[model samples]
Target: MEQKTVTYEVQQNVATISLNRPAVKNAINSDMHRELYSAFVQANEDSDVRVIVLTGSGDAFSSGADLKSVATEKLGDIDYGDYLKETYNKLLLYMDTIQKPTVAYINGIAVGAGLSLALACDFRIAEYDAKMGISFLKIGLVPDAGASYYLPRLVGVGKALEMSLGEPISAEEAYRIGLVHKIGQPEEFVQQLLTLPTTAYGLMKNVMASSYEHTLAEVLQMEEEAQTTAGKTKEHTMAVQRFLTK
Candidate 1:
């Protein structure tokens, strides 16, 4: 297959999706957008892929939508709003719904839809020096790619509004505000981030996703339900019996 804008590789059970356009800061052009959507769908279908990590090829995660592409394209030929609503929106929606966990390794700048992509992930692990922004306001545009939805929920409505309306924020500040789950020094970030797959982070991901929409009472019920369902699995039973005997 001719993979251009995005690349996918599997290690253990984790599927890593890299945005390959480093020359342009991994900006999301139409090709990259379509490629990412396809890749997510592929990962969802593959039973071998128990977890997914979304990252970029170079230092920057993504610069958001390709403004250069947007500037030259004619709105008359394509109904962009409809196109995005149907396709791009579905990408975030699917990411949220995927049974397996997903993580965003924000190694560098993540802006606009790029930030939304990070937000949509079950967890965001960032390099301490990285920058995150909902920079749509800078270009006189509204947030898309689930920014309008996820931002408010992640950082609360007031904080989300301020961040979207304000300039970009540093990754450290983002961590303090709950936007990012962990911040690691740039040199050690990749190695540090690998621990997430080995930890209880995947279960935490599922818990957080469920907490986002469910009430506290409902959430407790869900936890119990998950416990019961997981308890029946051979993997869970083996681990439980091993611990008991030990």
Candidate 2:
């Protein structure tokens, strides 16, 4: 079988989605967009997969859009907008909504839509040298693939505005501004990423993301509901009972 543009592999309970065109820094074209969406959906539906990590293979995480595709001007196809909306925008939104935890392992440069994809993840852990940007303005384009929405919320209105106006941010700066959850030495990033506790991370992720769109009262109700549901879960019940007995 041909290795797909986006490759999916499961190790333990983690489903890893790797963007595979390293030769071009994983610049996303239409095929890569489609495959990425499919991979996230497939992982979400797999009960065996409790967490998902999205990464790219190479010295760079992803350089965002493949310039060749834009140069071809094929975005004028009849269903082009809809196709992009579903495959790119909706896919990231779905990944955010999945009850499973999603991690963006930013091993290198992440620009344009690539940065947006990382923002959509529940947590972002990056190598010290990893760089991120909202560089659409530099290319005379507006932000797409959900950057306009995800970026501001992550780094505050003023900073997000500054970045999206087209400057790049380093991994250290990103973490300082709360855009990344953690940073590791480039050589140790992959190993450090696997240290997250899957189940606890998943539960906390669902709660936090849901809070974004919910009213305070609604969030309280949801918190109660989620707590009740979690109380019945094996992990929750066992841990709580064990703690009480101790």
Candidate 3:
């Protein structure tokens, strides 16, 4: 059997999608993208998977785009924009649309598109010493894979531009600047994230994502509708009953 470039595993309602190409720091390649998309789709469809976690195997989360594959293509003959529109954009759109809570467990360095992948997640928990940045400028390119959309929203325009134009920052600085939700030992962070009530977390993530682009009135209405939907969930009903008993 051939090894998968991306591996998906579900345990106790948590679905983990791991980038398996540790030899090249699990860089994003065409095959990995296909595998990742499939894995995410499967996780989203699985009734038992309440939360989805994305991480990479080995020491690095991902170095960035697979330059090796890029080298194989005829640079001038390829339309990079079309390439991104077909692959990464689809993946990003799927991540955005999924109602399940998604967490990016940045266990090590995440650069360029790797950082963008992390940004796509609703929450990011990185190893304390991990490094992250968008290094597209270094290579005479602009940030892709939704970095342009997510980074500025995450760390603010000034900080986002600075990071894009400069070097990678330590996870500690990333957390301080609001780029990441938390920095801790990977295992501890994963455990804490998994403890969150999945239904509530998903609804909250939807509200937060909507807040970025919606007017206050629109968001309030969305929140009202979401609350109604959430209130119908068995988890919410059970929790409410428990509270009443208490």
Q: Candidates' lDDT values, in order?
A: 0.80, 0.80, 0.87
lDDT for 154 (candidate 2): 82
List the candidate 3 regions with Cα displacement exceeding 4 Å: 1-3, 71-73, 186-197
Q: Encode model 3's per-residue lDDT on 28-138: one tens digit a residue.
A: 999998999999899899888878899999999999899888855587787889989888999999988887778899999999999899999988999887999899998
- Per residue, candidate 1 scores C-alpha lDDT tens digits across 134-240 of 98888667888899988998889999889988499998899899998888733244445444332244454577677968899988887776667666666666677
lDDT of 2 by residue, 1-246 (tens): 234788889887778899999999999888888788888888889987877889998888899988786635665554646756766877876776687667888989999988888888877889898989889889677888888888888878899889988788898899999999889743244445455444655666677777988899998887777777666777776777888999
Q: Over 4 Å off in model 2, which ranges?
A: 71-80, 185-204
Q: Rank the candidates by TM-score, best first.
A: 3, 2, 1
Query: What order do you get sorting by lDDT, best first?
Result: 3, 2, 1
Best prediction by TM-score:
3
**TM-scores for candidates 1 onward, in order:** 0.85, 0.86, 0.93
Cα TM-score of candidate 1? 0.85
Error of 3 at 230 (Å): 2.1
Cα RMSD for candidate 1? Answer: 3.3
Give the better candidate number (2 or 3) by lDDT: 3
